[model samples]
Target: MKQNAIRAALAAVFLTAPVAGMAQETDLAKRVEQLAAELEKVKAELAAQRAQAAAAPRTAAPVPSTAPAQAMTNAPVSTAWATPAAALASDTVFSGYGEVNYNRPVRNASGTQTDVRRAVIGIQHRFDDKTKVVAEFEWEHGVVSASDKGESEVEQLYVEREFNGGLRGKAGLFLMPVGLLNQTHEPTAYYGVERNFVETAIIPTTWREAGLGLSGEFGDGFAWDTGLTTGFDLSKWDPASGEGRESPPGSIHQEGQLAKSRDLSLHGALNWRGYPRLLVGGSVFTGKAGHATPGFAANDARLTLLDLHTRFTPGAWDLSALWAYGRISNTEALNATFVGNPTPVPSSFAGWYLQAAYKLWQSGDYVLSPFARFESFNTARSYAAQPAGLGVPATPYERVATIGANLMVGQGVVLKADYQKFRQDKSLDRINLGLGFAY
Candidate 1:
């Protein structure tokens, strides 16, 4: 009986062993199949990614870290004045420009001196692809204190919105699209140690106002700009001081400082660049200046400015010309208030300049440009009628000629030397050496 039981048990064990082995084989096969399916899925995903990358649009590779400055140095000079039309940089960008100078009066050595002319810091923050904010803070001279000639001010503060079809609008303080330099007058943007007299004295370089403005660019090489903004305040005019004699608009310019919005100004500009490396444009600004300020004598005063400018860059040559004329109406009554002042309100002022620059030499990121400019301006061209012997005679046009050379060390750093000759006042002639940078 014991032997029979042992045989039965052995048979049962052998039978179950085969079934268990089969189950193990089935489980192993299932795991292999699952792993194979996962491998195929990964392969499909990688192929899709490769195809998408191939179909994507090709973009120019970014410039190497060392090439940005070199590329900017070689860019066309017209790009320097992008202003409101310039595209917003991706993310946040920091920029700045400044200059330090040494001036020696040719006739008086005692007047020789070296000083910091200006330092500026600017920020551009992009909230999205189409909206951005820009601001610039500047310090003039070196120090800003109660007794120093230095000052701190906002050069620009504005928010810009980009619309469909190359149109852009900006509000807050912004530069007027008037002259070649007003919008892009960084130290590295121009050829001289100092700005041209016509732009600086007549049109007021770096002129800006607070208001709304529109700018548009077209595919046909045409651009347009228009704006309504705060204007010069005649109530700020000082007849006793010679400030007005130096720059009529600069003296009375509100600069958005507690500006009087009672009077708004209109400005418009049109530009054409149909030809290669050539640009021509014109601008006009007109407005009432009195703002109905209480006790102001020139309530009816009207200010009008007109300008025509052209620029051409051909190979190694750069040529530019500009003419500007300004007039203030109803100034006769205002001049009567300045009976004893030698400098009275002027009815009209005009200026013109012609400049030429040659790319004399270039190597790597270094360039040398020699330039010459001739300009004529009359700040006090014609004063209003005053009582006998009370009237101030119109000053003769002052002619100036500047010869200079600019040495560019990198993308935005320059060393400049120039000699200025004054036809009206030789005593004002001087030699200037300057170092300037922008980024």
Candidate 2:
């Protein structure tokens, strides 16, 4: 009995020792799990704090100004941005411009029109310092389908090359460097809601053609560009129609879309910026536009234009002027070929405009410019010779005076208001408002 009792006691002691060890192990495991969870929480909090610190610098950073450096280099700070060549980064760059306009007639003309005039997006890709490709897509009146009252276009698609001695070359479809407005028609670039009458009527503002061109700078602020380009087509001319009244040469322009290449034209321009804050330029274009029409007897329907323009900005005042003269030969022969036209084509057209604007106020991000403009144009200044009574009257062209103010909220955004007076026989007046942006 004594031996059995001793054995039982020993067994109980061994079992109790194992139970105590299990309890201690479970408590240690629980403590390890809690420590792991605490470590994870601490890690998450540190990551969030690190992220906040990294973003704070960017949010509070200031935009750097290069204006002082530009001034020191004698470079004009007119655009308030880096130079085109310097602004591009290693990546493809994107830019765009847009405008919305409203017009109300104050005279014999009826109705008002509001239009989303244009939306343009452009992209540039640089292969290297010497070569780049640029393209622009345009939407007019917003909608894109042919069934709508809107149109879409590839405004620019060109490859440019930089060579020695400030020389540059471009090939493919591009804006013709004829007038000031043709090359820089972003709404914010000009003063008014509508483009000037002289450029629109005579110079054919926004003109572009498919061609190859060379441009370069010479001695002391002199630059020149010349190109061979596809010319207009006289086959599309319809004399008795309202479309012909749009512009002298623009009405017949095919805009380089699968253009008829039978007749090519030469154009040249020279610009001199010898004086500070002043630029003077002249351009010429001459070509036979008939495109070798089959039915016409005199198919050499030649067109020629000469334009002179200048812009001067002195302190608070800005002055701009342009004069353009255009002529078409062999129009009589071409008019005779028109199947059902009651009107005759003009032989000569001329237009001119002068503008002055003063910076009324500028502070911080706000700028106000009050401007005035005077214009005169004659689309049909003289007609091709015919029986006196057979052709329509070609007399004094229209004259106009415009006054306006442009308020800029930022470098790339503007609000414009203007009043226009037509001073001609059977005149019409109008008020215009517009909003514009570019980047």
Candidate 3:
């Protein structure tokens, strides 16, 4: 009985041990299968991630820190003047230009002088997508005084708007867009240390007035500008004023903001840029200058100006030419009105200039330009033969030649040296040195 019982117990033990061992083995196999499945799923996921990554578009690299800053800066830029207001910068923009000059006359034209020729500060503000305002103030000779050549003036203060179809408009005190230099007279834009004698005497650059104007491009490089402005007052004209006949036409300009508008003037300019490197233009201004002189005839005191200009650039050479003719009717009446004045207004005045420039040398950061200009003008081309031998001085005529060179140290900074020879009543020669910049 003991033996049977022991054997039965041993058998049971053996059976139970084997069953438990099998079950444990099965569990281990299941765990291994599950782990294999999980491993395969992870591998598939990784493959998919890599494929997606490869299919995606790559982004551009950030601006390189080691690249040349000037190369980036040289990129072209569009400003609010051409684009809509919405494209304008949100912050106010400040810009200006300045020039300093040293002049010495060889023939005693004037004593040698060193002075700050011009210092200008401009402020620009964009009010909306289509509206902007600009104002500029200028200081000449670096100071303002009662008994000095220094003075302060407003160059521009105007509001501009952009319309559809390449049309634009501006109002307030602004420059009259007649001549190239009238609108863009920064020193760096031209080669001379001083402005050309023709434009200065005839067109009167730095010419601005309170008026409204329109500018637009029609098509195929055709453009136009027109304006209505306050006319000059003949009452302010004096033969002995040493301005009109004795000096540049600019001297006779009544730039006074509160100027009498008894006579309004109309001016228009047309330009064509049909060729890639050439521009041709013309302008006309007509009005009664004798606003209301006590003795002058009504509208008989008219002033008319006709100007034609052209600029050409071929290779490294630039050439420009301008011819301007001006006429004043009824100068006899003006002479009769002011018989005692020494300086008498001329009935017909004319001027012209031709300029040429060549790039002598240019490097990555430096440029040298050599230029020459020829100008001729007669302020008193024709005046009423003084009534009863009132004795009006001889007409003033100027034939000038300018030779100069400009060294550009940077983008907008220039050093200029020039010599001017004059052929008129006296043969005068002058040497000028100028430093100018814009930013």
Give the TM-scores of the predictions, in the order they appear: 0.82, 0.80, 0.77
Off by over 4 Å in 3: 1-88, 293-299, 385-388, 391-396, 425-427
Cα lDDT of candidate 1 equals 0.80
Best candidate, lDDT-wise? 1
Q: Alpha carbon lDDT of residue 79, candidate 2?
A: 31
- Model 3's alpha-carbon lDDT is 0.71
Q: Give per-residue CA lDDT, model 2, range 76-188, as digits (tens).
A: 12232123443432336677888899999886456788999999888877676678777888999978795988988898888888788767888998777776677777776
Candidate 3: which pairs clash? 85-129, 86-129, 239-343, 240-343
What is the C-alpha lDDT profile of model 3 across 39-81, one tens digit per residue?
6676787679678655653321111111111122221111212
lDDT scores of the candidates, listed in order: 0.80, 0.75, 0.71
Ordered by TM-score, highest first, the candidates read 1, 2, 3
RMSD of 1: 14.7
The alpha-carbon lDDT assigned to residue 386 of candidate 1 equals: 78
The prediction achieving the highest TM-score against the true structure is: 1
